[model samples]
Target chain A: MLQWRNSLARHATRQSVSVLFTSVGRRVELMRAFREAYETLGLDGKIVGVDIDPLAPALQVVDHPYIVPRLNSPEFIPTLVEICRQEKITLVFPLIDPDIPILAANRTILEETGARVVVISSNAVALTADKWLTNQFFERLGLPTPRSWLPAQCDPDEIDYPVFIKPRRGSAAKSTFRVSDPEELRFFSRYVPDPIIQEYLSGPEITNDVICDLEGEVLSVVSRQRIEVRWGEVAKGVTIYNPDIIDACVQIARALPAVGPITVQCMMKDDVPHFTEINARLGGGLPLGIAAGVDSPKWLLAKAAGIAVDIPPLGSYQRDLYLTRFDESFFLTKDDRAQMASRCL
Target chain B: MLQWRNSLARHATRQSVSVLFTSVGRRVELMRAFREAYETLGLDGKIVGVDIDPLAPALQVVDHPYIVPRLNSPEFIPTLVEICRQEKITLVFPLIDPDIPILAANRTILEETGARVVVISSNAVALTADKWLTNQFFERLGLPTPRSWLPAQCDPDEIDYPVFIKPRRGSAAKSTFRVSDPEELRFFSRYVPDPIIQEYLSGPEITNDVICDLEGEVLSVVSRQRIEVRWGEVAKGVTIYNPDIIDACVQIARALPAVGPITVQCMMKDDVPHFTEINARLGGGLPLGIAAGVDSPKWLLAKAAGIAVDIPPLGSYQRDLYLTRFDESFFLTKDDRAQMASRCL
Candidate 1:
């Protein structure tokens, strides 16, 4: 019976190829781009999209869609792997950061069925997942990071007053506040469940999408700084070049030997880049980077399929790219305003 | 805002009480009895049944039901806790053995919402979950237990032939196999996955439902030998009085300062009771024991609620009280038959 099952599986695998794609919230544009890429590649395979929301538009575009419990959860990785097993998935493309960590941890488990896994290692994912910890890592490595600390865990007597508090593991700026007093510190901890007390670095935040090879060699790097944020997301963002930020991105990318298609986020302060965090998957601003001539998805897929990835020429690519979307914005309380102003922005 | 939320929570807690009850598989009798007991006590609280199966009968009887994932699984516990937080669950009742360990570990997290967790500690739960480990624990404490060892891990020169390979974490002869050669061991591992190769004792198996207090002081212990197992579960059984078994149960209860019902299974051979495993929650034969004037659940809850559980005199309790149920008999392959004699009658 076991032999029969094995032979049937082998026959099926030889007949068709399968790819698993995991997403959190809405990622219609990313999924559409993926479909376009696969079609252009002329691969005879199926793309399966997994999301907690059954009604997500990305699901509609995929060949096979499975509604898992939630994507912003630890279960996403295991649940997607289970789906992969049932569907005989050949490749996995993580569309979100949380899935990266889980996929990396259980890569062997997913690959047991002769399906190869394409995920950043758990160590790489862990180093980049927590914004505050990522910044600390950069500082420890002398790679330039904004001064950050937990006000609740910090000594007020020695450090500067008025810091920024943002929820550590979140996309967009939710529950982000500015505080200048012990009273505010108390309130901030009470308000934000997992707040990161950061030394608000001066200047704007820039997001750089970089695709690297298996040996930590950078193939392409494109940057975007948030010019406008509405309802905790980059509602309007423009692609720009900062030499320091680009250098830092290359340095960070070169440090991760097994990671692919990671996004480096930082703030440029006085012509110096202060790293904030790294996302181990495609960033939301991927289209801007792709339009700027990075072709990160193609490069990422090549590495995932076990094909050798050639580092693209480091010549100047298209810049001055921008993306705009409508979002709701609310008032920052009086304390919130002071906290925001203190972040040296 | 925190104070207001706290006040609102307090108000709700005062207004109505709701307890969470998580049960495994399709056991409705236990859940119904719990509901009846709570309603009789004028607690005005509802039993919330959680199971992976959508068709679980417990769901029909509970005031609120969650047909979620497995309780021990990574996804299930967090989802269960999230539901508890959203519903303001006050008390958590772990009716399943596997869920006991997880629930016990997260007791502090559950109790953070001004709720009470009535569970044994994680250490106790872990100590009793695995059969081989439980027996080893008994042997370590100088208590009587069946001589057993995994032939594969055992010293080759010391191992006896015709050894029984039992599922390391399960019973009722389902994955059980007997092997006398390397070929048989290879064949058995294919089916059992990780069977414990043990020197199967020639004796009948018996189960004892021992109810203990918070400090591990025994209130009552009832013994029942297995007459039959339907689909790897206790379906037909006969009550018996074995003082040695009773002493072992008391010693185990005393070793672990558990605060709830515990069921200990043993095999009696040569007038000696061999410890198999200890169950943190009530057993399947508890209803029959209750019929025989045990009232285990009432005694347990009373003790947990700070009431005394004084077991009535054993004057009315009679030994050799046999009970039988008609269920589909399991079909054992030839290998299974060699491992376990068909004791169905």
Candidate 2:
């Protein structure tokens, strides 16, 4: 661990790197990870959180927390630009899928303020947002994807039972359902709006936190098997060091014009990996990869500081590491409370 | 049900009203409720969804949907104004607690474009945002709130056990817990970042859907018993006619300079209600009140449209009504997909 941490450090032109997390939600782990990165490097920097909800769990952890506005607001782009300029933010990243395109579309606007918006590409964002397009993306790359179809394109007779239904453009596991038979599918079709039905690959699910650089080169691939899930979020998971999964993730990073962190997800059936979905930004369980020593946050800071990151061989992240998520509390007091109150007022 | 819906229609002067839901997340039912109110009133209007998420479920239901920025963004205020101006929106309401102040603070910017922000006074926003101040709010009103204290203010030996530890300024049930003894309290205190230990009230919980007109007068109060809860949100619930609870809700509405919809929570012990928290915006289970005929949406739209709304008599709602929340689907087709795609590009 000691050698890995030191060898990971490399030569680069140091820049005063300040970071921002948009729509931070309850990402307290991410907040701590970035803060630790700055503290470890002995860098003079700050972590800022931008959230519409003032009471977000992550907001209380950062140096600067602001209750901004909605993503659909007209001031959305301008507001982000202003914050970037004012905070001297070197790197701006978003945790939600929808905000990716907004920041990417406003790349020029944010860049004008001398901030790098961490996103793959506009096309990647669009493809990832639309499941049908993403299926095509996987197909073209010769990667396995379940037989997916929109409601309009589906024939009830042709569709195999136990298919999975989800919102065509959904983030998180909120609107996903598994149907067992034609009757269930028919019943669901009545109310399941804007449905995307895919063949249910009832295999072990794997989450690959794929770290990429400015040149879209894969740095380290950390894979975990989401054994138990609640409400679509991984509640219990164990990390793995699968070579095939790493190769797929590496290929995905190489294929896409990705920058910074991109999350890859797939399911392994009969020793073959079938890709399901990909997020152009960081995944919720990224702390798992960071814990296993992927160090995406520090790498990001290094990039923002114009320092060359010394990445290890792909799939070198620790194997058989385990993680479990439990509910916990975080508080904001004194100045934090004052700032929160001031925002409300 | 028909008479209740009919009784809901009251006196109000009509104005050209367009509404926006900021930080709209997955509140699809709330969006549909507003649209239903407009259609019921025979009024020409539009319901718009503004969120940082490109694929918000609520966004697909609205006539207009835009991916806005985070509230912490410096341009949050200005971006909202631009959307209001471009969409000709007249009223902007926030469903999230933290966003209330953002809109209230930017009332001037929004009003410059002839838009009326649906927020209470900034002071009220601040008071309600801080749980400690909210305790004071209940105290001032002679309402029963649990015994709450700051970690620094608490004396371990004198304090009661099986107590609750919540953030002084907590939103939702994210950072809350029940401690059985000093050992657990001490252990939790070490981790629960900002601790606000309160005398745990173990009893039946009640949610009061209180509606106030633009004039800050009590319009209606509908109470429900949270029979079953999952992950801190009410899953199965039933409505009841409780006079004391209604009286308490009325007193709360009368006490605060509230506008639009406000949600009040309490725990009932020995047939008496003790106030817990106040959300100055809409509640998750508000569909019950709407189902029982407290049409706050119509009243809000009327207020925005320059129409006067005459609410029916207090406690004039259905009783013994039950509601079971089931998982279902909401869809977005070509236009929604196209709009989401366009936002990214």
Candidate 3:
């Protein structure tokens, strides 16, 4: 039965493109966006959502939902490959930070099953994952970044009292602190693992959604100033057409050579975009970008299906578009849990 | 024209209830719930939403959205009183934390405008708002509470490592940290303003929605175990009917004499609910409680309209009802912003 299904999916690839989303945790909007894209483009495809947890919200909305092992587990890659092979997945997108490097590192192996993993290069991931290296990369690219230092290399006396200290390899603002004095700086430096201390950028933050084609050519850049942030995600944001921010994002995309969607974050210092870090996956606030007329999901879907989509020039999207978000729920029952668990790989 | 409209609203009060939600920042779901309740009950009343910011998301959905002064501003209470008188608002609900005490303190003044402020007594708000005082209150009520100490009262050597430190008066999990050692605790105690130190309850958290009538009668209690939390709000949760938790919540309501909806949060340690602080307003995750069949919005609206609502007895909500949430956006343009600003008081 599995062989027959796989053959059927293979035959359907000419008119359709099946996509897979890894670590599809709470990304129900992204799943819905892709579904809408498929409908709009008149393409037939299956969206397979995989996560370690069966109760993942995004998994409930996809065409196919499968439970996979944790990212660190040895069987994870193999399970993904089998799913791709079975579902005839033409494109794969990693939705979270940790999944990106893992998928990028195993890109060749994943693509051997005829699935194009949508990720940046492993080198780019390495440069972006570590906060210290990201600062260095920003300096190397002539992009202004917040002045950062290693704990041992910096003198407390010389450093500003209200500096920022965070883990060198952390996401979602975890274990981050705003050190007010020398005492806090010393305490948090030891508290956080592999800490990177940086001068606090006390300015409005800008998050840019930089979309690129499969060949790493920049397609569109949509910059949104974060009005409010919750749990490291933009809760309230407004899109702005700032030339400098757009240019900085375009420059970063060109330098890093990102594929698909990458989110570039920066803090404005004296009206200049001081680039912070690049997330190699689609951002949480990508919905706002799409709403502002970039239509990245549609563009990506069109590209994956080998259709010629009208590509707008960079920075051509809408400006002053505001976004305010609220949580919507999916109600599940015990019976649904049982059915979901039965589909585990 | 205003007097005529007020008279019309007064006439409509027999079959409808005009609610005023103060500081309606991001309670879009709550707004929608009240709207749904109005529709379900076949009522005809306007929902007036007030906020200091014109860009608040919840303001977009209400029948009448008015931008009010900041809570700390001198004009805030008078403006609200004027709005309540002009709009003929029958019931007033405060959405955010800071709005609660202000509304409670001015309840009589607001009620003189013929609006019933849905808030607890000022004493209850005072006890709930201060974490240190809440700990003492819990102990007095014979409830299990985490060992907490004021900054000047506690010894660092006597405290356990990995204890929690936070502002005595804080919300949204702001400025809270887990102190791993003596030095960090000492540093953070001074760092956080008016800090309280408590034993960190290393267990799953459960947020209970305890609904009460205007007479301070316990209507129903719905307890949900928080499977995941983001920005101090439940991202994923499952409704559970733990009788102990329900009893504890009932005990709390009885002791504190709560009015309307109050949220009781606790952490389970060794299978016992160690009560944490209380929020005198509706919980952020009240949607889950409504979905679980408590239907607090409908109940509140019906009660305000003098319509008979069939609220189930305590501990009668659905068990194992799961909720998983994602953000949905409201895309607004510059014109919308101008119009919203024009509605300011």
Candidate 4:
């Protein structure tokens, strides 16, 4: 046991060498941030991607890549465990929320195979993974949130008109719809078995990604106000920091130590923080967190491995950092428009 | 969706078929009682046996037998899920407590695959599966319980002399030990990382197995007091009903709707019930429960499959139910023993 402890300690002191064991359907932005975190940690290890999708961009820079089925498939976790065991993986991280519970359940078994499973506690993961549950937990903690109820539980006669119905377990504006009254609620409730009826909080939506240890100690915190989302993924965002919201995020984090990497999303209306939901894994604006001196991926990996995390000094980076996807449509030439029109014709 | 629901309803009503999923672990008795409950319900599904040991007696009645690895192993749940899916299993009952959490976690996925996963909610599962957590939850509800602390948090100064130390997550008294002082606690705590230290309550150790519906309504409640345990398995037990302890058991059942087919153990002393631990699955005296008339296994499976549970009326069955297992040593005949002794000589 002493020798094992000594070996672990020695491994921790060396430069950060990281591996990302992932599958298909991962958000591109978060994957990029993992690479940035590797750079931030001043480690020699590069991002290693594993996905069955041959076209996934993650395969481009990955030091090693393995083609595997989608993470939701039955073979995904067992295959990953086998790879981690054979490869002597130091840390196995999961990008998907559904995968979080499954991975956390295998912590001890994976650790026996010499791979540290760094996922949030199942309690924290469940509470944060489901958007409706996230709102309920925050309300219980006396945190501000948009008025929300399950469509089946809500009576339009009892509430204000013009409520919004959103998927109970998704991110961004995926499957979000505005409901005017009882008819719409009835129609949608039958269509969507699980959805939240939330009183629309009119304001720009912003998300704060806070990384904390199991004991609820915040290692680094960063926030980004979302400007646009096109297909359930963030299109653009601007980074900002609010101390009050950050403190609330810390409290929520402390309440859920099993939540390793999380994002507390809230809407700001007239300087009031109205939390909408929480994500148990990396949020869309993770790159912004990385740019703002929050090396979340490295800290998370280190923490899961039971290694001490030395977060880069907070003063080392700026807070106004931001990122945006550069679509070719933004700088289309006349020739491109002519070609597009010709194709349409 | 409408057609699917209609077909499900039709399938449930047209079949009085009974199917049994049995494990050779500690909950074998619980499995038997559940079978009796099905008989009372007029469900036709026959019980099936599953264990790595093919010689398990449950195979005597079950038409289909499956051999699998240990229930606590990581491969157990996934393998069971695969089998259930392929077989179009209506109700996949888990007789073991540790299997409760994993089953509950993947319930949605299992249900989607045409098998109804029956287990309590994750929160309730954790509370009942962990002895220390169950004690704390009961105490908060003002239920009677002996003093207890998690071994990691136990201090010699805090515990009374002659306390009981039990592993937080094991069953059948495999990891239970009687310890008197700090020296013993130190020695035992070294083996198990998170044992629960409890004030030794001297009384008849009684267990009440209750089957409840999703609405927290009791279908049947069978009581048993432990007679003896050898090599960490119940060797002998007899069923008896105590109105005093039964009342407390009812309260506990109502406290968690997620809890179904639960066996709660307590100490009956001075005509008072002192709660000890909760097993979310069937208990060891399940066969006794079946013999006494409240067949739990069948009823639990029926309810899990969304079939109506025909709970037998109270006092409909006799008490004094008994169950016993012979030790392997008892299997040797007199001639075999003599031959063995001669060989030794």
Write down the C-alpha DockQ for each prediction: 0.01, 0.01, 0.70, 0.00
Q: How well is each residue in B138-254 modelled by candidate 4, as lDDT tens digits?
A: 898798898887665678766678988888888766657777667667766754557888888887888778767656677777777676544443444666767777777788888
| Number of backbone-clashing residue pairs for each candidate, in the order shown | 1, 28, 0, 26
lDDT of 3 by residue, B69-121 (tens): 88999999999999998999989988878899999999999999998998999
TM-score of chain A of each: 0.80, 0.92, 0.95, 0.80
Docking class of 2: incorrect
lDDT of 4: 0.64
Candidate 2 residue-wise lDDT, A1-345, digit = tens = 887766545322355788889988767778888888887765668898888765566777789887777899998888888889889998888898889989888898799998888887787778888888888999999998888888778877777787988887887775577887765566456545677899998879998888876668777789978866655566556678788788888888878767888888898888898998888888877877887778988887876677666778877776665554533333223344446646521
Clashes of 3: 0
Error of 2 at A16 (Å): 0.9
Q: Could you estimate the TM-score for every candidate?
A: 0.43, 0.52, 0.95, 0.43
> Which regions of candidate 2 are displaced past 4 Å?
A1-13, A331-338, B1-345
Q: Which is the winner by DockQ between candidate 3 and candidate 4?
A: 3
What DockQ does predicted model 2 obtain? 0.01
State the weakest 10-residue window (summed lDDT) of model 4 chain A.
A325-334
* Model 3 chain B weakest lDDT span, ten residues long: B7-16
lDDT of 2 by residue, B1-345 (tens): 887766455323354578888887657777877988888777777887787765455666688888766789886777788888888888778888889887888788788998777778888888878888888899999888888888778776678788888776667676577787776676556546677787887778999888876677777888988866655656556678888888888888777778777888898776778898888988878777777777878887876676655778988877766554433223233354456646521
Docking category of candidate 3:
medium
The alpha-carbon deviation from the true structure for residue A312 of candidate 4, after best TM-score superposition, in angstroms, is 6.1
lDDT by residue (A238-287, candidate 1, tens digit) is: 66776777777787777754355777778777777778888777777776
Q: List the global CA lDDT of all models.
A: 0.65, 0.76, 0.88, 0.64
Q: In candidate 1, which residue pairs get closer than 3 Å at backbone N, Cα or C atoms, i.e. clash? A: A178-A339
> Highest TM-score: which candidate?
3
Per-residue lDDT of candidate 3, residues A1-345 (tens digit): 999997677556536789999988988888898899998887888999998877788889999999999999999999999999999999999988999889999999999999999999999999999999999989998989999999899888787778999999999888888888787788788889999998898879999999987888888999999999888888889999888888888888988988888999999888888988899988989999989898988999888777678988878888898888878787788777778867876
